[model samples]
Target: MNQTVRPERRVLAQRVTLAHGGGGKAMRDLIEDVFTSVFAPPGMEDQARLMDASLLEPGAELAFTTDSFVVSPMEFPGGDIGTISVCGTVNDLAVGGARPLWLSAAFIIEEGVEITTLRQIAASMQKSALEAGVRIVTGDTKVVGKGSGDGVFVTTAGIGVIPPGRRMLAESVRPGDIALVSGVLGDHGAAILAARGDMDLTSDIRSDCQPLNHLIEAVLTAVPDIRAARDATRGGLASALNEVAYAAGVGIEITEADLPLRQEVRGICEILGLDPLYLANEGTLVLFVPPDQAVSALAAMKSVPAGRGARVIGKAVTAHPGTVIMKTVLGGARIVDMLVGEQLPRIC
Candidate 1:
């Protein structure tokens, strides 16, 4: 009889160095000790071998997406780089009506970053992956000079399966469709800004960081014919709505009075002269459903933990095609155009 021998785990240095990226024993130890040990990816192969019964179903389609996280202050009030890296990729798949299954994370580490930091990130990634019902199947790591990069930059790629007969397209949005948001907007952006502390600002707001796949599932279960969906991330809700309006060749009108916002976020924006509508959010998403089923969809979203604050913010219109209009609480209208330049830099 033959048996396989497992190698004992090796201790790694307290801080990363160039030796860890040299593809030698030091590299092996670093990978095994910090990342692989936490992720527990199947096999020690260079690539993942994936198989699923869902993939075998007729008409099931594959969905793939990749994103990079370079948020300043790798660790924040509600989450860190690892948490966002996984959530960002997973949300991308979820909003597109995909069931995320696998992820590959690649890290560009700067020399001297603490080993404990990497471990924290890996653990966060594992926790998030579990919550999203996905796996960290494979990954790579590269170390650069301390000043050459941030403490660490994470790039993640995700794969999912879209069930047959389910199709979501922005162009499918019609004038009668209603627009809804999962929850409060601008929490993540406000939280990240306060966390930086460069502006002598202080706030108790935490990043709205969490996996949205479950919420997406709930909404879809209630309204399978959701016309379009998009996670409000980098450019925030305003930019996302603009994209959809242009794609569908329809006009979008949102009521400021109905927008869900936290007091802390509003105060921060007011003091900084920033627009909350253009602020980023990690766990928030906007979707369009037929007017008749909009209430059902809102109820479904409210049933999900991540979407308890969901609200019906606006609706699509045919009056001004390819435009986004906002009806302010003061009975005035304004164009919520795309962000011209970076409002906050290095905000993942």
Candidate 2:
């Protein structure tokens, strides 16, 4: 007798569809097969139950932050939307003097996106969260029509604990304080532009996208007296420093030559009519410390791998309060104002 043969069952959907977002069996299967399978920790409550919310520790003050990622191309040289989604929120908390703890992620996926791509993004998020010493305890996913959404958009919310007596704020900065940067700037913005292949320009620039909580922790540990810290994100170092100056009622004077910039990034900015100081950076931070302690702070920061390129770029001053001025390389001074509008849009 001949035996009947059956076709093998496929484990993944070839493409996302309306049914995948309808909260039905298909949706559940997609979540289970793609997201939950990778995000849930071993012996945890699973992804669905994890979405209910996390329990906080007793007598803990929490730092909460939320950010959305809408970078074009989804993937970049050094990182992707998934990695930035986690790192952005984590850095937000860290700069606020918080020890990052748990995170919640939400996904808006467009129909017709490949399941394999979604899985890759989730895996990247998992890797980033692990590196930052945080847990992805909760998340939600929704699907949109093909034309209604980009391939994928991720929003991440993070919670962290602010250690006792550690208060880092823009308002805390004062005149005579020193300004320091963690590393080379504008790599993220330049890398994204090159990745788009819009200008047909090519260079070896890569995005400086990485979690900065570890680096921040090291600095805080060594110099708890640091007045302020801010990560250079959307508007880059220029905007971040302007915010500090305005909040603290002080002026900031930076030397053009002291600012860290990669040669390739400088060339890219020159070719693209961009300023490296105003370009976005994913893994860079600007710190304000008392001039007396600037040496110790810079040393502490340089001890960490992430801060090896750290430099004392400028100083907070009383002259021209609420403004930022740069001493140009050629014995000239220029006003570095806050960016009037978006230099680059849909970037983080």
By TM-score, the best candidate is 1
The count of backbone overlaps in candidate 2 is 0
Off by over 4 Å in 1: none
lDDT of 2 by residue, 1-348 (tens): 998763332336689998999978788788777877788743324342332122354445668899999998789899889989999999999999888888888999999999888888999999999999998887888999989998999999988887667789999999899999999999999989888878888778888888899998898878989899999999999999999999999999999999999999899888878988889999998999998899989998899888999999999999999999999999999999998898987778
Candidate 1 pairs with clashing backbones: none
Per-residue accuracy of model 1 over 1-348 as CA lDDT, tens digit each? 899987866745789999999999899999998888888899999999999889999999999999999999899999999999999999999988899999999999999999899999999999999999999999999999989998999999999999999888899999989999999999999999999988989888999989999999998998999999999999899999999999999999999999999999999999999999999999998999999999999999999999899999999999899999999999999999998999988879
Q: RMSD (Cα, Å) of candidate 1? A: 0.8
The deviation in Å at residue 194 for candidate 1 is 0.4
Error of 1 at 35 (Å): 0.9
RMSD of each: 0.8, 5.1
As for candidate 2, its clashing pairs are none
Query: C-alpha displacement of 232 in model 2, angstroms?
Result: 0.2
Candidate 1 residue-wise lDDT at 298: 94
Score each candidate by Cα lDDT.
0.94, 0.88
